[model samples]
Target: MEFSPIRILGIDPGLRTTGFGVIEAQGQSRVYVASGCIRSGEGSLPERLHVLLKGVREVCDHYRPQQAAIEQVFVNVNPQSTLLLGQARGAAISALVLAGLPVAEYTALQVKQAVVGNGHAAKEQVSHMVQRLLSLNGEPQADAADALACALAHASHATGGLATVGMKSRRGRWVSL
Candidate 1:
């Protein structure tokens, strides 16, 4: 059977740096489109947020992705840091929404497990797996790799219902969410 390709955009949002990746997925195949980071330079909180929002909107406009997946904010030891990150995420989400794209949220654990087959996988592991899976020429930066992983996970879930296809032994049991 033939399958039409779906374009996906994934975002890893941070107060200082936001990462974004775009990919086209068809069946079990994934083709990378672009990946990069948006730096919110030294500025006031509102100004930084404006940077993030505009950056995300520009990416969406350029890529014209059909779907978007974003890494969910995890609570940090510093509540203030977490809150700031959440604001950044809100900015990113706002851009996606304004672009009329459906947004899906995935936790870091979920992204790591889907991409690297381990929930506790380190950033390097996630990067390595993302490069291997996407057949990237070189390892992407940490944040960009994470965004790619998030897109890959969404592809895995949206394409063939393969979220549980090869995960039985990885976690020693069938895992489906």
Candidate 2:
């Protein structure tokens, strides 16, 4: 079989700051390319969303990732906060779509489980694990680390049917939700 590297972009979307990470995978080996957070100044919702969209598009343009994955927005204590977060996610997805990238969605639980071996993993745990997994010089910021974890999860999902595909392993191992 021919071998080709799969480049993936992972996004953690937020109203004030949107984090993005890129990775290249070939076979079981994965390499981190770049990661950063796009911060939007104090502004209205529309303006913030616009900033997020532009940042995402710029990352897509620069990295040229073949695929993209984003963290799913979960409900917050405040309904308004949840709604705003969802809107930010929508803006991020729209930017990826406009760039013609196939986007995959994964929940925060999945990302945490994949990276830190627990659904209730803390942010610091994620940052530490992401640094080890990607062989980074140091732990990334929380947002960027979360984005990198999303990319790592997508790489794993593509290689094996852990969550998205729901396929069984040769040893008949299954991922418990």
Candidate 3:
């Protein structure tokens, strides 16, 4: 039996540029719908957060995705940077939840591994693979490519990509174990 396609929004959250990508998933096949970055500009902390939130909401409103995937924020050497990134990530996740969508979180390593078969793959490698996977005419922007990779990762998990990763789903969200 055939099933209707489900749309997913992928987010690569950042303070300055938050990337978003949308895709339609039908069975095992996935196609890109839209991908772009939200430029929060050089603004105050609250201002930046608001920009991120608003940008994500706009994407949600436009795409009407059933679910979402977000790249987990990693710690940086500078604690300040880490904290700011965490805020951005939270804003992005909140936007999706506010839209009544389930969210799935994946670490950079997991996203890279799922997309390029190497957890340590470079950004250029990821860009190449996403183009191949989606049969795009050219490579997407770096941030947009990362968002697309995150969406692809979530789709991979749905197809039983790896069992050891052990994703736990609850409260309309899927979190890595």
Global lDDT for candidate 1?
0.90
TM-score of each: 0.92, 0.91, 0.90
lDDT tens per residue, model 3, 16-104: 99998898878779898999999999879999899899899999999899989999988899999999899999999998999999998
Candidate 2 vs candidate 3: the lDDT winner is: 3
Predicted structure 1: clash tally: 0
Off by over 4 Å in 2: 164-177
Provide the clashing-pair count of each candidate structure: 0, 0, 0
* Candidate 1 clashes between residue pairs 3 or more apart in a chain or in different chains: none
Q: Per-residue lDDT for 75 in model 1?
A: 84
Task: Compare candidates 1 and 3 on TM-score and give the better one.
Answer: 1
Misplaced by over 4 Å in model 3 are: 163-177
Q: Model 1: runs farther than 4 Å from truth?
A: 161-177
What's the lDDT for all of these models? 0.90, 0.86, 0.88
Q: CA RMSD for every model? A: 3.3, 3.7, 4.0
Candidate 3 local Cα displacement, residue 159, angstroms: 3.0
Put the candidates in lDDT order, highest first: 1, 3, 2
lDDT of 2 by residue, 1-177 (tens): 757989999999888888899999787788999999988778898998999999999999999999999998988999999998899999999999999999998888888877777878889999999998889999888788888999988888886634556453232123543
Q: What's model 3's TM-score?
A: 0.90
